[model samples]
Target: MGILALQGAFIEHTKMLHRLGVDSFEIRQKKDLLLPMDGIILPGGESTTMFKLLNDLDMTTTIKELIQNGLPTFGTCAGMLLLAKTVDNYHSDFLGTMNIAVKKNAYGRQLGSFRTTGTFASTQNVPFVFIRAPHVTEYGDTVEVLSIVNDKIVAVREHNQLATAFHPELTTDTSIHQYFIDMCQQ
Candidate 1:
């Protein structure tokens, strides 16, 4: 598996994936992205900056292609925003492959950042850190809601794609990463 290492807590994500026994590599450039792979995780970062970098490197089209071809992908925080079909306050130039409407910075701002506990698939009371996170307002029929907060959708899975508004790598839990790996295996 490969992880987008453009920004955010990518190192933490790599560490967690390593702990999960998944041989993962950091994808810094478009050349680093290999096809016919198992999965890819887009780490959280500045959404606008990441989008610009991907465009500059000509990776935007390729990423959409891979996702459309049924490559399993996991996106977190800003990553989730990139995968959304629509994002409020941001230009409509994202990947738009997840078929979900997202509200950027749904939690407000940095001062509004906070942590909470919630039940994940196999983990209970998982510590989720929300930093300028996006919330799903609507999803397509193929999307599966995984978790919610204050009645807002926070996590979702659609076919080979998985997304979370919270930073699971910021916590010590490995269940979520493991779950992604399991999905890749299947």
Candidate 2:
């Protein structure tokens, strides 16, 4: 497994994966991507900063290739923004793998960060932490909305890719991380 360490909450995701007994490492540069990665997690942070780093590190092409070739990927918050097909205000498309349009920081600023318990798809009582998170404004037919809060789409799954607007790694629940792991195993 690999976590994009250019920015954001990569450490939190790494810790969650460790607790699940899954050996994972950080992908800090293009060289790091040389290591075999079955799955990758894009953590939450500033989308514009992540975008700049992806290009600065010259990793946009290879990372997109990996995901396009069916690497199971889980993105949270800014991760979600990067994978989105279209962003309302952002001019560039980071990955644009999923066919979803999102509004960056639709939940407001850092002060808007909050916790809520919502069902993840058919499951119940999953904890979510939203901090300047983006929500799906619209999705294509193939995209399945997994969770919604305040009537806004927060989580979605498309084939080998899974994305969440909230920071699932910030919470104690491991189901979402486990769910991504299972996807990788398949």
Candidate 3:
């Protein structure tokens, strides 16, 4: 597996992947991503900055190509924003692979950060932390709702792509990470 290590909580994600017994590498350059990896994870960070860096390193097009070729991806928070089809009030320069409309900081500011226990697939009462998270308002026909909060879609899966508005790596839980690993196995 490859982890987008440009910015944000990539170290946390790498630690989680280690705890899951999965070998992962940090993606620093565009060439680093041209490998035979089963899956990739875009850790939560500043979407605009991350996008700019990806473009600067000439990795954006390569990443989109990989996604189109069926590379499973897990995006959290700002990472989720990178995968969305459109981000309201933001520039159109995004990955735009996942067919979902995202509202950045839909839950208010960083001080508005909160937690909730929700169910995802077969996992019930999962503790989710939201920090300046995005809210998924719409998805294409292929996107499946994995979890919801306050009648809003917070987690979704589309083909090989899985996205969550909350930060799973920020928590002690490993189920979500395990699920993603299982996806890699498939």
lDDT of 3 by residue, 1-186 (tens): 999999999999999999988999999998899877999999998999999999999999999999989999999999999999999867666999999999999999989999998998689988899999998988999999999999989999999999999999998999999989988889
Per-model TM-score on C-alpha atoms: 0.96, 0.98, 0.98
The sequence of per-residue lDDT tens digits that candidate 1 reaches over residues 35-61 is 446899999989888888889888999
Error of 1 at 47 (Å): 0.6
Against the true structure, candidate 1 reaches a TM-score of: 0.96
Q: Which stretches of candidate 3 lie over 4 Å from their true place?
A: none
Count of clashes, each model: 0, 0, 0
Residue-level lDDT of model 2, residues 1-186, one tens digit each, is 999999999999999999999999999999998799889999999888998999998999998989998999999999999999999977886889988999988978789889999999788999999998899999999999999999999999999999999998999999999999999999
Regions of candidate 1 where Cα sits further than 4 Å from its true position = none
All candidates' lDDT scores?
Answer: 0.89, 0.93, 0.93
Model 2 misplaced stretches (Cα beyond 4 Å): none
